[model samples]
Target: MHDRPAPRPQAPPARPPAVRRHNLGLLLGALRAAPSSRATLAAATGLTRGTVAGLLDPLVAAGVLAEGEPDRSRVGRPGTPLVFAGSGPVVLAVSVEVDGVDALVTGLDGQVVHRSRRRRDHRGLDPDAVFGRAARTAANLAARTGRTVAGAGIAVPGPVRGSDGAAVLLRAPNLPRLDGCRPAEHAGALGEVPLLVGNEASLGALAHLGQADDFVYVSADVGIGGGIVVDGRVLPGARGVAGEIGHVVIERAGRLCGCGGTGCVEVYAGLPALLGDAGAADVAALRTAARAGDPAATGALARAGAALGTALTSVLHVVDVGTVVLGGSYAELGTWLVPAVHAELVRRGVATGPDVAVLVSPHGRAATVTGTARAVADRVLGEPDLLLAG
Candidate 1:
């Protein structure tokens, strides 16, 4: 019988595309957290050595990962470290605030390769013009880096529809030009790259994911907004507005907000409201005044901190997070702001349970910009096929 046909071998089991994708993400995420050898990665990811090797081939080929020097410190055979490639894919991040726009080219490891800032009065600037400026800045950054641009992320001062990057600014009193404007319409210099538009505070919160598993990020710029992280994930809510803590009503008879609502936290805690003829041109000046015992500045910050505490109390009641991160301009005021906020929370009794801790963001005002780039880079890392396709 032809020597029994030599017992034909059976083909190995096939893994579905989704399973492969999931495994890829797991490996990439492990490397992102820290560089590791193949054996260590396999153990951490619960994938076999051979399976991890198989998954790493494509990533290495795509320049998403690089094999580092072998570890001679280990016994017997040495293991090479797998790390994010220095020349890996990058993302363009654009942050549009009330005053101006910032563009940055960031690597997968969240390092800013190139950065540019344009300070222009955006009060009545045309929305298209705003995007154009951002696009030009991004183009310049890309030209300087000469790396693959995986995608683009935009952090806007106003609300953005989560569905299709539509600007849902009912009325951005601070940034009226963005009102009724669709930023996605004009891709500007970014061209056909994938675009993601989100609230500045929402994206800013992502920068702190590595800092804590759960925390509330409050961004105090020209306006006040927040981002809530619950159990290591951002809570964008049903309409993607979960972290709009700025609009949470803190005072029943407070001043009118740009959203046409009364007593909104922003109406009291916003930069303009807090300044209120304090004779301080900017947050730095205001901080100096507060440090020098200017009652007006100190009083303004105290009231703002109280309003933040009120909104955050409601946030903690719902999300039960233990940490609140002061970001943006608030970070500059943390010396006094954190104390005032903590006092208010203590007064309201929300600071007792979980032992609430208020901290200043290491990224400071750059949190939103850094987080925006990180958000886009994360997507690219999750689905490296995008880079391969490009």
Candidate 2:
């Protein structure tokens, strides 16, 4: 009868790959949050001990994790600590700013193993040159560390589109040469390593995920950029350009912006705008002037702060995130900027019981670079299978 349909080879058991992936993610997340013994991982992940052991076997064999000596300090039977394998896998992080490119190699535990920075004037910066330098630096670092580079993340001072493997730099008005630069195409030195390109501010915000779950990260540099975190995740938006706060029009017919917008916040709140010709050659000088009560510097900062506050008030109302972290140059100017932002928030923010907190980033100027590395580390940790594949 119709060749008996070859006994219809009994369909394989319904083993959903997603469930396995979710369990793996849970166990890995527990370990990353804090090194834990198999028992602890099982308890934390709500997976049975056998399941935890089963999952750990492949990870340990793949060098993604390691078991340490039994902890004799425990009350009951001692348990061996599970930790990320130090020599297992690493990620290459590249931060491309207006004036420099920083390459960092970071471990899964968020430790920076090696780093190199190349400084240059970005007026007519060459994308190929920057990519070449970053790739060389990554290659050298990988060679020295002897750790497989699982992935790479590039933090650009502009909007990036698409995934890590094929990122496109949409626009960097400050560094016009980087426009349309797709870093993935130039990463020959990184071999077959996965690549990710993201906005510097967004990555900076990602770096601070350990601090709070919901907050707005404002990075004021040559131009202002922002990263919004809501519900414990960075909001990348539909176009991955959700945090272009600099372009928020604060003035109806204000100063012209490089993005062809008038009265944009960048025109007033950016470092250059705050500096103007106020006799301050750099951020330090600008800070000194503001600290010394120089009218031009302080007044400029006050105006910028007010403008920033106005924009942030609108942002806070929409996002409703209570915390605002001033990063990059704003971190340096927090003394003068926070108060203005606070005042405006108090005046304009929703009547939610006074919970707003604005603070300077302790990560300092390296926040972007550190965040880039951390982002890569996070990706690898979230998907340890990548290490196995590598």
Candidate 3:
């Protein structure tokens, strides 16, 4: 037999492959947060100025970063600042919803360079077919941009329970066909670019940064999913189901839900439930009816808001998140539901007027897509070395 080489021993100070990747990620993340001089980057990343320069030079040469004039405002001798390249690569962000799929390409600075939507019925379609179409649509959009596609992020209507490479959709009642399917793979949908997959509401909450550091985001659609964020970070929980409040029991003996439960919050607050009860075609029709003083639509929305509040109260008692931000289809008609939701929260002592109250996402249904952009950007930022290699 050929001689076998002995295993290498653990070394100190010298960075191995993992350590180098970690430091690269740290430096890139700090740069993404804000443009800074090499000295500031060294301080922020806890690396020596020499080390920082050694790492930052390659990125600047690769068109991933650009140097700006030194900031003379600082106390000591100022160094030239570094910023993300203006016309560099962009992230291909995609979202797969129950109704349709939307895709957009955004720069590292979070500017939307291009966006498109495939408006068609996705419900009941084969999971492989739907995901294939989505992946191909995203690829086409990125190609049209004619810019480097750093990576991609896909937000699904279910709890994701894995890493970016091999994520699995745990359960999706609305898109039942996607249950237990890997979002990146279907009948051959995974693409050449790196991919990141996350729950839609979770990503929405991630994108909800700067609005409220601590709040509960309600992604109201065919099913209502809650995303709990504390100190600006989402709580994914033990199994990626932290904010799944759709099954919270609200009415002891009420209507049966699709999850085989009776009186669950979804049976009352879900878009399908609300629309069926109000006899409206969709949120737009419901809004028109409510604005025209139609009792059926108004009454249906009122009950849904109440049910939403009740479900949130149970979660609030434990999480104690004081703010509730509504997104998805809910934003289209949030005004009609906010009052009742606020009233119930007040009655339950979980809310106290303007200080702790309901809010609406300005991005509305687009929140998930924007959030996916952020995620994909981070994915590339974390492994910037790969971006240059490709």
Task: At residue 224, give the lDDT of candidate 3.
Answer: 82
Report the C-alpha lDDT of model 1 over 1-390, residue by residue, as the tens digit. Answer: 011112223564788988988998888777878888877877788877777777787778878778888778877667778887889878889887777778888878787798877787777778787777777777778878878788888888866667245545444657676676667675578887888877888888989988887999988877778888876556756564678888888888878887778998887787888777466788889988999999888888888898888888888888878899998888888998898899888889888744999989998767888888878877777786676677
Residue 210, candidate 2: alpha-carbon lDDT: 79
**Tens digits of per-residue lDDT for model 3, 1-390:** 111222333453576877788888888777777788877787777876767877778988988788977777766666678988877799988889888898888887677889988786888887778888898888888888788888888888888897475888998877788899988875244357788888888888767766887998888887888788897667767676778888889998999987787999988899999999899999999999999999999999999899898998898888887788888888888888889889988888877777676888888778888888987786787677886796
Clashing pairs for model 3 are none
lDDT of 3: 0.82
lDDT of each: 0.79, 0.79, 0.82
User: Which residue runs does candidate 3 get wrong by more than 4 Å?
Assistant: 1-27, 39-52, 69-79, 187-190, 238-240, 293-296
Every model's TM-score: 0.90, 0.91, 0.83
Q: Which candidate is the best by TM-score?
A: 2
57-172: candidate 2 lDDT, tens digit per residue: 78899887898777787776777878888887877888877777777887777777888777866667577776766677667877799887888887887888875767888988
Worst lDDT 10-window in candidate 2: 1-10
Deviation from native of the Cα of residue 84 in model 2, angstroms = 0.4
Order the numbered candidates by lDDT, best leading. Answer: 3, 1, 2
Judging by lDDT, tell me the better candidate of 1 and 3. 3
Question: Which residue pairs collide, candidate 1?
Answer: none
